[model samples]
Target: MAGVTAMTVQLNRMDRVSPWGFRLQGGRDFRMALSVKKVEPRSPADGQLHSGDAILAIDGYDASQMTHAQAQQMIRNSGNTLQLTVNKGLFQSLKPTGPIKFSPAAAYGYSHGHSTF
Candidate 1:
């Protein structure tokens, strides 16, 4: 932890509450996940898409009403080129790096691993 960068999220109560206080408004917004709390999936994506994807961008475009398809006809007529920036998987927790915690029996000389930021 010498000089690692950290990321954080700030939230407001209004974010959790419905805009109109209607029961239908909540489910219309997002999908819940362990890694990503309220993930946004593109419309015309009811049962196909899901949470936990990195979602860089869609076709180099933001998920706007025009870009995010609505009608089935729009989805069916989609272009073959799908440019996306996906995280691809869930975020995993890291283990602590304490001193001298190797189990020699299972060490096999290359026990530890490396990762780049």
Candidate 2:
């Protein structure tokens, strides 16, 4: 018999540099993209990002086009501020304009939820 152990990190702004806490899951195929699986509370992603949010772009880096590792690296490299182009809903629809941007210096933190995944 074999056993597998998993650990979930409590994403905290003070703990992480980027503070954009979210689980990335996807990139299996063309149809499947690197999307948000879970958004942690008391973190940068808490209020802004929902569960189903297909991270179209992070600081202009396309998640749908890039591999999962690439997207993660981009997010980590974003530092304290992050500019995201996201599609929110059951089905992703690309809008011509309007992007969401958040900086660590802004009014944010604490825990809550409104998951769409």
Candidate 3:
């Protein structure tokens, strides 16, 4: 909590059927904390959340001590509009910088027009 900064984010179901357009990673294993791993471009969480932002709570429910599966389940049950309380700075040190390394085929696709960077 020392370096953490808490904030709330409200994400509405943009497509009405798709997932929240964000991926989460990390938990207690290997001493890792719960954090956002990715946010899809043009998605609801795209600009609202960032990779390495620690999930401190979900819909006002404490999430800092939750396991990956537990947190996933909570998100799944949050309905169309979800509220998330996150620690924006707590896990920023874990965020990756520069382009991510990919396999040759994937890299080619990304470099071309098949994927978004």
Find the candidate with the highest TM-score and give its number: 3
TM-score of 3: 0.70
lDDT of 3 by residue, 1-117 (tens): 475568999988855477687877765432567777778988878899887788788899888677666677778877788899988846643444688576563555522111111
| Each prediction's number of clashing residue pairs | 2, 0, 0
Which candidate ranks first by lDDT, i.e. highest? 3
Q: What is the C-alpha lDDT profile of model 1 across 11-89, one tens digit per residue?
A: 1122322221100100111231112213333322222223433333344433322221121123223343223333433
Model 2 compared with the native: what TM-score? 0.57
After the best TM-score superposition of candidate 3, give how far the Cα of residue 61 lies from its true spot, in angstroms.
Answer: 0.7
State the lDDT of candidate 2 residue by residue for 1-117, as single tens digits.
133222222223444444566666655333466556777777677877666665666676555677555565676766666667666533342222665475332345511111121
Least well predicted 10-residue stretch by lDDT in candidate 2: 1-10
Runs in model 2 deviating more than 4 A are 1-18, 28-31, 91-117
Ranking by lDDT: 3, 2, 1
